[model samples]
Target chain A: MINWSAFVVVVVVALVAAGVLVTLFSTALRVGDGDAPWRRPVSVGLYVVCGLVVAFGLYLIIPALHAG
Target chain B: MLVVALVIALALFFDFTNGFHDTANAMATPIATGALKPRVAVAIAAVLNLVGAFLSTEVAQTISGGLIREGPGGVQVTPVLILAGLIGAIVWNLVTWLLGLPSSSSHALFGGLIGAVIVGAGIGAIDGGVLVSKILIPAVLAPFTAGLISFIATKIAYSITKKRERDNFKRGQVFTSALVSLAHGTNDAQKTMGVITLALIAGGLQKAGTGPELWVIVVCAVAIAVGTYTGGWRIIKTIGRGITDIEPAQGFAAEVATTATILASTHLGFALSTTQVASGSVIGTGVGRKGASVRWKTAGRIALGWLITIPASAAVGALAAFLAGLGLWGIILDVVLAAAAILVIFLRSRRNRVDHRDFHLPQPGAFVRPKKRKKAVAGG
Candidate 1:
């Protein structure tokens, strides 16, 4: 009965954790003398796609009894 | 009785590792900035950490109740499960230490525990909602909050001191360093208390829902304190000097940022990693300051280790748990593995002796002291 929901939840949580952490650390990401949020460019796309996949997997995999 | 002893031993071992693993959080900045002599800083930090460990066990209560399922059958924790986790966590710590990567010891500990629980008792044994809502939320939020706070704090520090002299700012580093150490004690040492308490509950030595006993708290605090005095120079060197150039103000800012975040989390019974928060704050300070470079390569290695520590330790824990189900031989095996691991770690650390004397010195000529002009700005 495991589905994408649990996986989604996991990915979403991880992404948020990563995102929030990275964003909070945004002030620390500036390359010497650089002010642009370089992390934004890669962070958004990377988190979205990866987050979805991870979430889907968790949703699917975690609900079952331990068959392993 | 033996099970209780083993669990207590495991908790102390974890506490010992926490003390060594997390020494940098409290001392790195001060050492880097020469605010306190390396030995002096660690010695002070070690004592305060012990004091802090005894201050509260709210977080320990949470770990006992929040992370795993508990009921009339008692805590449902097994010595083998905990031993497995300890093994996993120790291995991860050693590997990371060898590579000089600073990672979150908290996560490794959590990961090992969860992994063992899942493998041994099944997923039903976990409190997933609590995992996501409480521990996970803080774990993810804390470091970033620390980073942001450090960023703003650094900026504020920069402008206010823009008219001051530098020595005054360096002097300030000493106070902030002390706070970081105190905060480190409050946060990291409690984790050991929680684990040990969990073991006690599982072993029926204590009430299922109660906190650690006064004696248990004292022993863990002392063990961690001694471990703190032992020094985590590899991580200290890497964190203090490897990531970026930190000045007196930046060091103060990072410490303050770290302190605020950890105190809040601990109060709420959240099990976040002080090391991660400290690193993030240090990195944030680097980004806030001009001309500071974060060593991305080192950061990347640490990130990779962080990714693996949980799962890796969990696997080891699970395997250990499975074997422990075999009885006395399993305990014997766990003991051997532990003894061997300890000898290896002891031997490895001796390869490069970093005493209290050289704890603050950067690798010759590579020291990152702030410039003289900035000193004028800080003091004037």
Candidate 2:
């Protein structure tokens, strides 16, 4: 009766996604803290990657946007 | 027709309670961390919920998938039974709200329906396999799963970011929290839409096995949005301040974890509670951060509330179904009693009134543990 497989997938996905997002954002914050010329661009790039992940999340939510 | 209309109204009302009850899930941490002001946070959540309601209805389809038998060879569920169930859910929602406990509105609704079905129909009417696979298991795992994710995320968040860089996380929180609100709208509003659709079908107004009508979706969205805007500040204070002193980093971690977990569950059609996942995330952050004190007493109360929500609402649903079985006057009596209870709860809420101003912004770099005040320190 239990859909253990789906439950497992949810756990694994949540852990990985949350960990990656937090780590990326935090690393960007740390790198961007001091005003080094390269640091700003690097952190900005990381921020863009984070934005892409959020965009992917949006894509997942909008059923009309995706093909079944 | 009247019974169907009444049930739809009650379903929307339950959706509204769901909105305010769970505004705390997404907006609480952001509001607590001053990433977004309390008013601004709720406003954003409300709008996103409205938009999110239109995004998907996948979860809605699974809401009553096979829980109650209502076709040939099965007992037909009456609109009055649904009404009784709604009353059961709403009463529990309000009572939990009054106590500032973040319980599962989904569980309450399911429990109410299960109770009403059991009373109105025989135990044979309920599919125990579906109940266990969909609702019961998800209820048990949601918190722990979200909590584990949040715990790890929190640890990683604190490790890399310096105290001065905390504002980066604060800024990030606004976006993450917004995602949670959007996910909430897609998830929670769908539940109401599903209930209304089911009622319409049961009443023979809509074809069986069809999706919610556009009108149903729109109204449910608006009701939930308005309720989100109104804000359940009492529950917010309890989750935001009551759980643990949330910093920007921890808030960010919790919000991200919650958003991911909710979206994943929604995608998988797992009938998980957003409240449970959010609460678990916050508590997870508490445990993750070194020196952060978790109010075990408050956490225990929340855990207790989760454990009892289904049974408590079921008991009420059973009684309500019994009463509703008596005919029109009994239904009227249930309605009158529900209205009275709602009014009383609202008045009692005012006595210890909690609102946006109750959450004060903490000074940067100064870690302040929220004082466990016996009386809520409030202004007007």
What is the lDDT of every predicted structure here?
Answer: 0.67, 0.87
How do the candidates score on chain B by TM-score?
Answer: 0.87, 0.92
| Candidate of highest lDDT | 2
DockQ, per model, reads 0.02, 0.75
Model 1 misplaced regions, further than 4 Å: A1-68, B62-65, B72-75, B135-137, B207-211, B268-271, B353-380
How many clashes does the backbone of model 2 have? 0
Question: What's the C-alpha lDDT at position B116 in model 1?
Answer: 74
**lDDT tens per residue, model 1, B1-380:** 68668877877887888887788888888888777788888898898888777654455454534567865553466666777777777767766776677777777777777777887788788777866665555555656767777777777666544422333345546655666666677667777787777777777778877777888888988988988888788888888888887777677677766665554444333435678778878888888777678887877776677667777777767776776777889877877877787789778878886656666455443334467546548634
Residue B331 of model 1 has an lDDT of 74
List model 2 lDDT by residue over B1-380, tens digit each.
88899899899999999999999999999888888878899999999999999887654443466787766887777788889889999999999999999998988998898888889997898888887887777887988999899999999999898776776587799999999998888878888998888888888999977888889989999999999999999899889989898888999999999988988887875656899999999999999999898898999999999988988888888888999999988888988888998999999988988888787656454333343121125311
Q: After superposition, how far is residue B254 of candidate 1 from its true place, in Å?
A: 1.1
Considering every candidate listed, which one attains the maximal TM-score? Answer: 2
Look at candidate 1 and tell me the lDDT of residue B56: 44
